[model samples]
Target: MSREKLLEVKNLKQYFKSGRHSVVKAVDGLTFDIYKGETFGLVGESGCGKSTTGRTIIRLYDATDGEVWFNGENVHAKKSRKELKKFNRKMQMIFQDPYASLNPRMTVKDIIAEGIDIHGLAKNDKERTERVHELLETVGLNKEHANRYPHEFSGGQRQRIGIARALAVEPEFIIADEPISALDVSIQAQVVNLLKKLQNDRGLTYLFIAHDLSMVKYISDRIGVMYFGKMVELADSDELYKNPIHPYTKSLLSAIPLPDPDYERNRKRVPYDPSMHDTSEEPEFREIKSGHWVLCTTKEFEQYKAEMENK
Candidate 1:
């Protein structure tokens, strides 16, 4: 792993036992690097384990195997309680549903101040209150709104409160797990813009998980495509859109809606034919380009290489 990388996840796997003899692979052997100040987008269909990967990395769900290196420290390795608490302050997550993530019973002030209090970020009640107000203001909410309950705010406003809570700890790394997906289409842009501004102003690193390729393209520096608990493709956002390598990636890009009605009507939808592919055996992630990587079995990898070469 490069020393410059802020987070280096290697062969990370998270699996859950289902029936007596079956297991559900949620995040299977995923590997990626997140730089200090870059937004890395993880995109996939629902239940593809994109969110699982984010949750596992933050230690909300312990990994079944592999390592997560944060600032040269292996975070997945068992740590003392103090170490764990310190680590928590450095990393935070913004959940998918803002309304569900916040406490309906707690006032916005208490919600934002929760992390600050836990991390001992403030010395006194006044300091904590000031910090809470500052975070609210940072995410474009007024200080006076701190006394209001989450149920009192609109969806967008509730999401802003969630963002404020995430920012309260002044984290260096954030996992924005589909932060705008639950909002109105019109509100999506506003939330996305707020996240972008926060990243720019705070120099924060992000693992942005979403299903919207268009929004991922807008906010991400690099994007990783996940399918069935594995990352099939990863590349620079523009490069991936322009020159998608994996068949799955190509299909996904083809599905992005075009602005022109004529073009939209002419474009074909990517057929979802699971029978055409086999994921019975897990694939190892390997680099196909300098910075791009994919997970494919040895036989499948050779076949894909041959096909790309022929093209």
Candidate 2:
């Protein structure tokens, strides 16, 4: 991966008033950087705020606290319409649910061309039509499929259209929020391979958010483990899988089933007990190894250091 940081999120937080008496902290104090031309996977269980983090960074929802810096400019800061439009073109998002994200009323051509229209990437109807057709072909769909509405396409096809729409603006960074979770098992790999091919061709940067650790390991250069809206661990994808430090991360990794019958039979699910943490002091994110970070208290940090040394 490149050393240059394309996107930096520092202490980002998103909170919502659940009701008159309760507040839900969807994302709290998340800090990470995505390098140019690299995939940074954000993995966690549902309701851990991985989706909220993506939305907040893309400015779909205003952040309750902290800052998101994209290519050196603050994302949460207010900008003029012209500046905002430019920023929007630089960053785009692919939603989780293919059926819900696309417009049932609009044709595939119109849907893909929405970004082109808003950004004025094309000059006229002819150019727009050509661009849409090009994008459709780029995402594995043909020019003939352009006239059909989203409802006519299958789940995987709809997602390809969604990807085409995001790519229409030629964005430098894309937040793929659980893009494959809603697809069938067989179709998931196809979508992932397409995303990989697209990234290779376009030199794109991605924040691939998902709950599937196995898939995340396959696609991401680096991974961050989130629990209860806080980032508990961050490391190289292979490193994290080889040596998961946090209790929650270990618990998560243990849950992935192997294809082998023998391995599946022997696998023991590691139950995460949050109460095991040292509560005398609040846990802080600290670098235990060169590039690995984990949230832990002072005592736990020492123990983790010893654990690594012994490993």
Candidate 3:
């Protein structure tokens, strides 16, 4: 791992056993690096293990194999209880479902203050109350709103509360797991803008997991495309959008609706053929261009090279 890298995930795999003797590989030999202060977007279809990758990296789910290194230390290396607590303070996750993530029984104040209480962030009860109000204000909610329950707020407001809770621990890294998918389209931009502002203000690093290609392209520095359980392509946002290398990535880009009606009508949807795009044989992620890596066999890469040459 390099000194500049904040998080290094190498060959990470997460598998589950089902039936008599079958294994469902949710995350298969994935590798990537997140720098100190950048949003790395992970995009895929519903069951492609994008969320599993985020959870596994944060130690919410133990890896079946491979390493998740945070600041040059392997997070899965079995540390002491004290060390684990410290590790928890540095990393946090904001779940996809805002309605289910927050505790319905607890007041908004209690929910936001839970992490602060656990981490002993405040010296006394008065200090804790003040800190909770500060967190609420940071996410655009006022201090008076802290006494109310989550049900009182709308979907967008609830998601903001979840974001406030994640920020309570003063974490250096956050896994924003589909933060805006469930909200109304009108409000999605508001939440995304808030996240971008917060990232700039705090210099936070994020692993933003989502299926929205347009929003991902807007917020991410680099975008990674996944198929089945393997990473197919990774490159800078503009480069990937301008020149997608992998077939799976090309298909995903094609699906993003164009703003111009004439262009949308002229565009053809790319079909996903399982036979033509199979990863049964594990594909190795290799650097095909500067700062761009892809997973494919040598034969498949040659075919792509030939096609590009002809074009």
- Indicate which candidate wins on lDDT: 2
RMSD of each: 2.4, 0.7, 2.1
**Candidate 2: residue 43 lDDT (0-100):** 97
**TM-score for every candidate vs. truth?**
0.93, 0.99, 0.95
lDDT of 1 by residue, 276-298 (tens): 65476756776766776766777
How big is the positional error of residue 261 in model 2, measured in Å on the Cα after superposition?
0.1
Off by over 4 Å in 2: none
lDDT of 2 by residue, 210-281 (tens): 999999999999999999899999999999999999989999999999899999989999999988999989
Q: For residues 28-95, what per-residue lDDT tens digits would candidate 3 score against the true structure? A: 98999999889999999999999999999999899999999998899999569888889999999988
lDDT of each: 0.88, 0.95, 0.90
How well does candidate 1 score on lDDT at residue 234? 91
lDDT accuracy of residue 106 in candidate 2: 91
Q: Is candidate 2 or candidate 3 better by lDDT?
A: 2
lDDT of 1 at 227: 92
Q: After best superposition, candidate 3 residue 232: deviation in angstroms?
A: 0.6
lDDT of 2 at 147: 96
Runs in model 3 with CA error above 4 Å? 1-3, 277-282, 306-311
